[model samples]
Target: MDGTIINSIASAERIWGDWARRQGLDVEKFMPTMHGARGIDTIRNLNLPGVDPAAESALIEKAEIADVDGVVPISGAIDFLASLPPERWAIVTSSPIALAKARLAAAGIPFPRFIVTAEDVKVGKPNPQCYILGAERLGVSPSECLVFEDVPAGIKAGEAAGADIMVITATHGHPVETPHSTISNYDGLHAHISDDGKLSVVRG
Candidate 1:
């Protein structure tokens, strides 16, 4: 959600950079992997000695929730999301529910009826389970889902879940290498549902 529909890189990096420094880690090496992942899962993966992943993640979430100063919706994201059927589109985000809501509000995006947030999943991105569950809960097969993602792990997750993907490059600091379709934003795109109820997103 952050990278795909919302651009919160400045706020995110500020908070995460602080966390990295606190852990005496290199920010450049540490920051990239943090995007498109649950904060707790990211912290847990670090295996930092004497660190409580849950607590550390909670702290980070609090900071992010409170720091939405530069958070803004990607160009055309708001209108694009509004154009889609609420039940047909779900936000499969790695952020905790509170933080997700906060960020969405900051970006002026409404809450979708169904959101597969970090709390709803047993595992996070790159695991396929999150996206798979999202598809299942939305009453669609994974192959019927079209995921918009901005990070490699998320793209891999969508691929593993048998879903098509569109890479959003709006917030990328450097070129993202992906074979999947790419879009800088939701501009010039339109969402359509056929008579049979199959959703199709097309570039206008």
Candidate 2:
């Protein structure tokens, strides 16, 4: 849900940056690697000596769940989401359930009827498994879904799952280079369902 439905970057960076400093890693270098992936996988990828990825990840999740000070919905995210049929949409996020729900509540966005959180997946973003599962749970084929993402990992995951991608750049600090369609936020966009039940996103 982060970056797509809600902007949690401030809270995310604050907690992760603190963790990186405690780990004696360069915060700038480590910060970019943390987003769009599970905390445990991100920690494991560091391959730090004597660090338990699971433990570190759990701690990070706890901090994330508590730090909702700056978490808020992307502009127009609330109404845009409300405009869609609930069953036709699902949040597939790399965040664990508690953290995910916390952020969504903090952002004032409705909790999705169903969500694929970090706790539900063996592999995280860029694996395509999460998105694939999301589509399956929605009773739709991957090719029939339009996945919204911000980071490279999530974009890659959506593409790998064979779904059309719409990149959300509202919370992106750096320019995201993607050939797929892009939007700054959900503003002015509407979801339309035809009689055939095909969903199309239209811009005002």
Single out the weakest 10-residue window by summed lDDT for candidate 2. Answer: 169-178
lDDT of 2 at 153: 90
Best by TM-score: 2
- Number of clashes found in candidate 2: 0
lDDT of 2 by residue, 20-43 (tens): 999999998888899899999999
Model 1 poorest 10 in a row by lDDT: 195-204
On residues 79-110, what C-alpha lDDT tens digit does candidate 1 reach at each position? 89888988898999999999999999999999
